[model samples]
Target: MIQITRTIAIDEGELDESFVRSAGPGGQNVNKLSTAVQLRFDVRNSPSLPEGVRSRLERLAGRRLTRDGVIVILAQRFRTQERNREDARERLIALIREAAVPQAPRVVTRTPFSEKRKRRDEKARRSKTKSLRTGPIHHD
Candidate 1:
């Protein structure tokens, strides 16, 4: 079982991993060994995640999530397949943990009186400076 958090754990069977040839500084190993790990998690079909977490995960996944609601994480940073696989799993857990936490709602606030006054004073100063740069008004 893959534990995302204390409350959330997904069975190993749920995660699908595919190996593909990696392109990098692996020399001949890059061509021969499929080191890259493609981790696919079906967010829409997962019984482990809560509805809110699934929705947030979908949004966070962005281009990584397919139309079928599968989140694909490509792990190619490591040369070894095992390391890459571990990296991908860690990333998946981290992403889900992030989704699990509810985001604090932002509260709208009005500008303070002192702040408004300061802004007005700055604008007045700028206008006065610009007026000084211009030639004095002449009465014909």
Candidate 2:
């Protein structure tokens, strides 16, 4: 099981891994070896995630989330399959951990009276400064 948090643990079976040839530094070996790791996790159907977390994960997955609600993460930074696999898993874990955290509700606040007054005062001061720059005003 992959422990995402103190309360969330996902089974290893939930993850599907596929290897494909990665286009990066590896000399001639890059052409022959499938070092890239593609990790898939079905967030919508997974029993491991709570409803809130599942929704958040789906949002966080962005373009990586497929039409079927599978999150596909590609890890090709490393040249070896083992390293790439680990990278993919670590990324998944991080993503899950991020989703697991509950977002705090934004507290709506009104602008302080003092602040509004201060802004108005500044605007008036600027207007005065500009007014003084002009020639003596007549009965125009």
Candidate 3:
């Protein structure tokens, strides 16, 4: 089972992993070893996630979520397939955890009266400075 948070946990079966050759470092062994991990999870079909959480996950996933509603994550940072797989799984868990939390609604705030007055005073000062730069009009 993969635990996203205290409230959310997904079955291990929900995660699918694929291993491919890693591109960076590792000398000749890099060509022969399939150390990279590709992890896939179907957000739409998962029975564990609430509809609200699933929707949020889709939005939070960005490019990771495919058109078919599958979330794919690739991990190639580690040199061994097991480490890469673990890394991918951990990333998926982190994503799910982030999505599962409800965001607090932002409270709209009004500018303080003092702040408004200060801004107005600043503008007035600027206007006065600019006006003083002009030569007095000759009334002849």
Candidate 4:
């Protein structure tokens, strides 16, 4: 079980890991060994997450989430499979933890009366200055 928060724990069986050959630093070993870890978690089908958290997780996952709602995390920063696996797990936990936190409601604020007045005054002043740039009107 992976504990995401005091209330949220995900079963280890829920995570699916696949290994692939990584593209850097290992030289000849890179060609032979599969060091990259691709971690997939089904956000839509998970029983561990609350509805709100699941929605937020899907939104946060963005491009990482597949059409069927599986989140794929690729961890290839490390050259070893163990380190990459750990990195992938850590990233999943971090993402879930972030989704668990409730977002503060945005407070809609109106423009202050003084600020509105100042803007109107500035516009009037600009209009007056531009008006003065024109030559005097002549009547035929």
The clash count of every prediction, one per candidate, is 0, 0, 0, 0
Cand. 1 Cα-lDDT: 0.93
| lDDT (Cα, tens digit) per residue for candidate 3, span 1-140 | 77788878899999888888899567898999888999999999999999989999999999999999999999998788888888898899889988998888999999999999999999999999999999989998
Report the C-alpha lDDT of model 4 over 1-140, residue by residue, as the tens digit: 99999999999999999999998567788999999999999999999999999999999998999999999999999889999999999999999999999899999999999999999999999999999999989999
Clashing residue pairs, backbone N/CA/C < 3 A, model 1: none
TM-score between model 1 and native? 0.90
Measured over all alpha carbons after superposition, the RMSD of each candidate to the real structure, in angstroms, is 1.5, 1.7, 1.7, 1.4
User: Worst 10-residue stretch by lDDT in candidate 2?
Assistant: 131-140
Error of 4 at 65 (Å): 0.3
Candidate structures ordered by lDDT, highest first: 4, 2, 1, 3
lDDT of each: 0.93, 0.94, 0.91, 0.96
lDDT of 2 by residue, 1-140 (tens): 88889999999999999999998778899999999999999999999999999999999989999999999999999889999999999999999899989899999999999999999999999999999999976895
Measured on C-alpha atoms, candidate 4 has an lDDT of 0.96
- Model 1 misplacement above 4 A: none
| lDDT for residue 69 in candidate 1, whole number 0-100 | 97
Which model is ahead, 1 or 3, in terms of lDDT?
1
**Candidate 1: Cα lDDT at 72:** 97
| Model 2 lDDT at residue 24 | 70
Q: Which ranges of candidate 2 are over 4 A from the true structure?
A: 136-140
RMSD of 1: 1.5
